[model samples]
Target: MVKPTYSPRRRTGARANAPSSQRTLHLGGESNPGRIQPSTKAAPIDTMPITSDPALEPLHRATLRVIGKSPGTGLVLPQCHIASCAHVVGRGTPPGTELRVQPWGRQPVEVRLIAIDDNADLALLGPPVDAPCPVELQQLMPLPLDGQIQRGDRFAAIGFPKNTNTQTIQCEEIQAEYEFYTHRQNQPSLLKLKLGQFRPGFSGGGLLNLRTGRICGLVKETRDEYQNLGGRAIPIEDLIAFCRHAGLPLSHAEPPPAVASEQAQALAAFLQQLPKWQDLASRRLFVQWALLNHPHAGDYQPMGQNPAADAQALALATLGPGATDAGLDAARQLLQRVLEEPVGKATKAEAKRLLKLLDA
Candidate 1:
């Protein structure tokens, strides 16, 4: 991959769980540790609360419409004419490849590609002009792994639909799996929005976690019946891995930094050592930690009933919590032995989970 040339701001080495810098101060002389007052400058008490209303937020308000025209004899060409589109695509592309949309009765305006995931039909565009408050990329959050996402779980879709200048809004819950596809064919997860207000031009928007506001997926398509389909967001963990592999800076808002090859060497060494340990307890913890921290493409279910499950259960039981540190070490060694054998071992599910845990 060609290296992205931008530099990123260096992150201060803060603990992952530390409080954010945007801490609010409380009035009235005293405050609870758990509750802080909003900053006075945030919003007036009498005015509408933008934070609570997704539509009111500047990010939600901004939208990018991908306008395309099909030449009679060739492929369709896409144009980013919307205001938000221009904001996101600014100065990001090479001279000729920069996105330009010809507005009615005027010359074309320039836009830049903020990011693009071709497999997901998602591309973030930036306007050529700057704004006082730029839209921020939402943080990735965790999802339930052991269960199915059911109907009625509230969700929000953000995107510029119908190649318009402003974003079309819709908040709703999953009605059902409107469609499904294999992983090889661009597995798009289709969702039915509660509100019946989805349209074209809303592709490449984000579907966010209602409670935490983290981005869970990228909106790719919407049916006239208000069915929303999206590609799951690239897991934060995977993003980190890709960045490391490509020697790109994790922070993108700033300039790029040099990455030493030693970091990659260290990561490879860690992965190599993981399967060699004998203790099951330690291995289990490590595996669980990996799954919890990583964003996977989908659930980790092993196939069918058989020795795979047995082997996995045995391995897990051998390493389950509370095993002595030494016992755990032993279990890890045994699991390695089991993995080495081609057949006659744990159920497929168990093996799959184990392998996934290790990969994560």
Candidate 2:
């Protein structure tokens, strides 16, 4: 239960959903307002976005603004997979149902329902055949999921809340690690949480553990009222277990391939130094080098950028970090495709090496 507190930017005042920053999110649905919007500062149109929160860095593209069962959020993980709550995507939603997802500032793309689990309230979707990814920034190294949760630990989630003029992200604590059963169900798969301004769009969002820089749960329920403020989420165990049973890459080995706690900080630091998705070849090479903790890793030219958008870079990050096999296949697929096209020797060689490593 070591809550590592190296938070250089512990959000002290001005919660993201404070009245000053809060927007309208009508409970009616997506059209209630429109598809949720990404933070201009987080995902700028003219320039690239940068983040100090190591835990949330590299996640902007991963956490997409979705309009599923309603105007809820979604997570676009490695292997071209998207995970969200069945409720938000429409519980009992049949496979083959086409849904549209709009990444921060990207255009809407269609995804097909590949799997759904009603008992667990989780659903998995796959990208269109013509499209390789739901979002352009595919080098998405999502934080690994912690096996368990302890009471009083701080957790955060980003989503499209109802009545919010703009999409918002919120953080709170586990009021109780115990399971909570709802009036609609017989099982107690949901864990209680201290709700803030979380509204409708919060469903299906991943609950991140602020301390370990790992995900701990899948948000399924939330309350907006400041008075009866309580929320519930499907614990990370259920999410991982479901991913495993579905033969997905999300939980690959279920260890910590996404990134170790110490490395997550290092990963975020390395990302902060760079601009934002530049020089695909160098960025891809740098990730593998950095993940291995090479001494001269930062010496690479043009260091101030975020490589989260590079699919190959993501493979390198996934390959080395906690050594999770999540993005290996996806990255390998993209690199193989790139090889078919004419490119520089360095780029070709690096792509080959990354593909080989993923194979190994």
RMSD of each: 16.6, 18.9
lDDT of 2: 0.51
Residue 123 local lDDT, model 2: 76
In model 1, how large is the Cα lDDT of residue 63?
A: 24
Model 2 per-residue lDDT at 239: 67
- Could you give candidate 1's per-residue lDDT for residues 125-233 as a string of tens digits? 4345452212211111122111122112334444322211122112222211212222333333233333333344334344443433333333433444343332222
> In model 1, what lDDT does residue 65 have?
26
**How far off is residue 108 in model 2, in Å?**
1.5
Tell me the tens digit of each residue's lDDT in model 2 across 35-94.
Answer: 533333333322223343544544444576556766577776558777888877887777
Q: With candidate 2 superimposed using the best TM-score fit, by how many Å does residue 94's alpha carbon deviate from the native?
A: 1.0
